[model samples]
Target: MTRRRTHLRTTPRGTLRAVTGLFLALTLVLTATGCGGDDSSAAASGDGKGTITFGYTADYSGAAALAVAEKQGLWKKTGLEPELQVFTNGPLQVQALRSGDLEFGYLGPGALWLPASGKASIVSVNMLGLADRVIARPDTGIHEPADLKGRKVAVAEGTSGEMILNLALREAGLKPDDVTKVAMDASTVVTAFSSGQVDAAATWYPLIDTIKERVPDLVEVSETKDYYPKLTFPNVFVTRPELARENPELVKKVVGVLKESGDWIAKNPEESEKITADFLGLPADRLTGSTKHVKILPSSELTRLSQDGTVGGWFDRLADIFVEMNKLPEPGKSTDYYLSDLYASAGRTDRT
Candidate 1:
């Protein structure tokens, strides 16, 4: 059965539907493999033939590379019959990949922990996390991070929004418990904050713009970009390890698509944003400042980062933060999940 693509606005306004049955799916796959399946090392196996179901988040900025690939015919140019699916967040995409519902997907910081914890393999690092922000209603008088103390702030736990909020609170010498955290999905954050049900909200774009449009005077109390150097957030590409190991050529082709689309996006920022805006049914002007929020590095730079272990270090640091927050039992082994050789395999080494 083909899963229908979900757009950001299409999900229920105040609900974050959990993708249940992950354990069941994995259990079934493992049982099948043990019973007399092919000699594939991983539970989920793909021949890398036929239509490739690609998953991406449903936002103009997050889907920029994919939208470009689709619009410019890059997928077919690379000999891939692509089926693009839109997910509301990274965990859902991860769930699909584990169940063989998707061959590849783009994930944000919120879901990066899954891959780091051995849920999937990281093939590429595509986008930087700069869109996360905490916006407060002017009447709340939450001008600074410390002002959040005792006030209700809507933030989705286990997402980038929580990371941004925690880092901000740390800088302000405030603890997580200092403020009242109103846990909600990204969609509900907008509704709860706009209705004055919460004092402020922590989220990312294009939802940042969405919230601003509702409360014109919302204050940007904190943003992930402000915590750079000490902290870094990334959006990455992932696939099942079994698929990458068995069909290296297919994985290489997908990497090629990522490099091609990323290179095109880097050289043509304005045109790329326009293409993404049109693809997402959003007005071009709404994406005016969106390009600056995500650092879409060129292919050469990505290769350099992968080779030097810089990319792996990024995940390690993120895992440390999660561990401190008690989200993970321990820090994940970056090398275990991040396949560093894929960049060179895709031939993106030339620093052009």
Candidate 2:
């Protein structure tokens, strides 16, 4: 539960060079059509006056904390009429966004990369801080990251949870091949680990809490710190590029509302916890610990996180990791290719 500090260095020279080339190419594409052209009229609006279909997916029945956030009408409080969907995993939620069935939703850091590079023009508008944890049962004998070698680890394939495991392995001076990875859903990871099916499990809250409740002597190994300093800022709010350009104002409103709701949560933790627990159908007592760990960074923090290539730099590093792990097709351009205007608009200094 200790906070890990990350020092953000300036973007590496090679990354900057590649970003420069990509920026020029993008500029050429934009200039050919006239630089100052505005597509505001082409954008979609809400139902007549103030209703829009914001989309969201979570294992509401399973992951109580996320479910609580959704069921509490936090998005609605943020002026978004979210059309909620339930998905078992992050990859499936990203797929829903790619198909255009949903315009925007929460996603993992890894899920944002490929779609942004390919057919889906996704932009990370807000970042929900690290909500995942890595836990090992007492019987498994995994006292630390180094203990994971040759042991069975259950992870849901293509999730930020799985990606965290990969990053942790590298941090521990091991490789993915060094352990036995058993792919399983979030609900089953703990049970699988308890039954000796796997030595450890990489999963998020509720599950981690559940496992710890069942196995009190379970060892806590490397967590978000083991990965990119701050758990790679796993849960992020993302939208498609076309949607953002067409309706920048709406996007701005959505972000503004989320910021307000997050602020409210920060001020009224006990009430917020009650709302979350009731919505997720979990005991209010269990809510205190889980909610305390969920850090909702302010919109200003999100703005700084996106600016000066911090977000881009992280993506580049993630891409390199993906390639090294052989998880992606190839490393893609991180700067010019990803959208930043939403954060720019959200943090606009001159609103007049």
TM-score for every candidate vs. truth? 0.76, 0.68
Per-residue lDDT for 247-344 in model 1, tens only?
A: 87778777887888889999998888788766655556645666777877888888887888788888888887677566679996798888888766
Instruction: Per model, state how many residue pairs clash.
Output: 0, 0
Candidate 2 local lDDT, 100-214, one digit each (tens): 6555555545455555355454454343435566678787777888889998888876555676677778878999889988876656777886676777887766566667677
Root mean square deviation (Cα) for candidate 1 = 7.8
Relative to the unseen true structure, what is the C-alpha lDDT of residue 60 in candidate 1, on a scale of 0 to 100? 46
Q: lDDT score of model 2?
A: 0.53
lDDT for model 1 comes to 0.72
Candidate 1 Cα errors over 4 Å, as ranges: 1-50, 137-143, 146-150, 191-199, 210-218, 278-289, 324-326, 348-352
Report the C-alpha displacement of residue 268, candidate 2, in angstroms: 3.3
> Cα lDDT of all candidates, in order?
0.72, 0.53
